[model samples]
Target: MKLRNWLTLVFAAALLAGCGSPGPPVDPAPVGDVQRPTPAGTDMSGQVDNSGPAAPECNPRASLRPDDTIRPGSTMDDIVKRGYLIAGVDQSTNLWGFRDPHTGELQGFDIDVATEIAKDLFDTDDPPIRFRAINSGQREEVLKNGEVDIVVRTYSITCERMQEVAFSTVYFEAAQRVLVREKSGIQGIADLGGKRVCAAENSTSVDNLTEADPQPAPVQAANWTDCHVLLQQGQVDAVSTDNTILAGMAAEDPSTRVVGPPLSEELYGVGIPQQNEDMVRFVNASLEGVRQDVWRARYAHWGLGEVLGNMSPPRPVYR
Candidate 1:
């Protein structure tokens, strides 16, 4: 046989030898291992300096007195003319300011508090308002940048923070505490000596941890929920923050519980731009009115009494 014919016959035999009844196609093995994603700005390793000159001593709870007079061209006047109040809020902090999974509507004590302000501003039960969701670290930045007219998130008042933005009278007081798995053998902050604990970056919780006597390694996440994720994934041994936040986390995961004595007293206030004194006073006045009735009702509505006990709103103090 010719060489060409011989080669062709060999190829035909090879094809015939390989042919068989075909079955369902099989997927190839995955190329790489899947990794659960952490939220943006998560920092597994970061250091906080606790040695800074003790932030200029001032009573963080004291703020300007309530003023209902909205002068022409002032911040409140502008907001009134705009027809809708823009508020910065959180959507993942559970009872404080979280989204309702069933209705897809934002509902929480903080949301209600912000809504009360809007209602009074427009003089209606259903006021024109818009809620802008933001992370814990973005509270001051949003106010300073004028991205939001007011930040009603769990924004703690601090002397350092006061320099950049203004605050309304204290609205809620939360205590810093620790959250750990029920059976993690970690009973309190004393037990967290060398363990990794998670808190959102730029939060006062990190400072508390770093300033502790036997400091546990502090890991920073982008949000409080991200800290919860770290706790669940075993990336961190505990999550520490405000009691209100820790209570929400415990409610979300029954396997965990808040432990330890309070690390610090955190006084939350409405964040406003330094230039917007009129807005601050207006919000203070709104808060003053809310404390009379709406605050207590909303606190009970969010079921906070079960976790935080029946509590009254913090009284406003003027400087």
Candidate 2:
């Protein structure tokens, strides 16, 4: 048999073998064609429409100056009065913001950051906060529609996004990279031409992968974990995203490894609504304390130091 055909047969066999025990005795002959299950809201077409209003010509990292005190009648005050802060977050991106399977609770670097904001707003170490699970594409939509007061799901600060939402100062800095199977023979973005690379829909990873010189075909999944799944199933040639996120996926799967040099620098910021400038300032102020006091502890607690290295919190930049 041809190598391609042999690989395909092996892939199909592995899928069938992992589908739990045989439900009942069956005849030797099987039904027609069995298809692979595509994740919900997955887009295999490599086309991504990025058309929109041009972003303002300002430093994306330069945010509103931080104020130590929250003003009366401000967005922060409203959140305080409401008893709990609503934070939009990702429940799948392992280390950044994922649900702990053991405790059935949300915890990660992003969750810790959001908790710091709530603590500052409510003036308590243990603050009342509700985490609303959202996917990559829904981060801006939830903030715009008031579904969540803030989004901390590894949200990168970009000029184009500034038109749609407000952002806090940079809290974490990550670099874009590639993840591939151990023997995939793919070294970096340079080796990806004509191959399938998967990323979450509307994520910076998709945009960066689409713009590579020898671009691969883009496969959009609902989340990064889904991208990891696609890679394991032999559906995609590689997964491309921030090294911070790729580290999480790599930790979960031992057969994969991250390769290539950094493609781009991604500065992460908290996502807030465009109209809520007060809240943005409040978050920035809260981040000032977080960077100094909480960031290192949370990073160590999550064991990110082993994979991501010991890095200081990103220094704040004010407009």
Identify the candidate with maximal lDDT. 2
User: Candidate 1: which pairs clash?
Assistant: none
| Residue-level lDDT tens digits of model 1 in 40-110 | 78887746656666678899999998998878898888999999999999999989888999998998888
Worst 10 residues of 1 by lDDT: 45-54
How large an RMSD does model 2 have?
13.7
List runs of model 1 lying over 4 Å from the truth.
Answer: 1-37, 49-54
- Name the runs in model 2 displaced over 4 angstroms: 1-33
**Model 2: per-residue Cα lDDT over 109-160, one tens digit each:** 9998999999999999899999999999998899889999999999999988
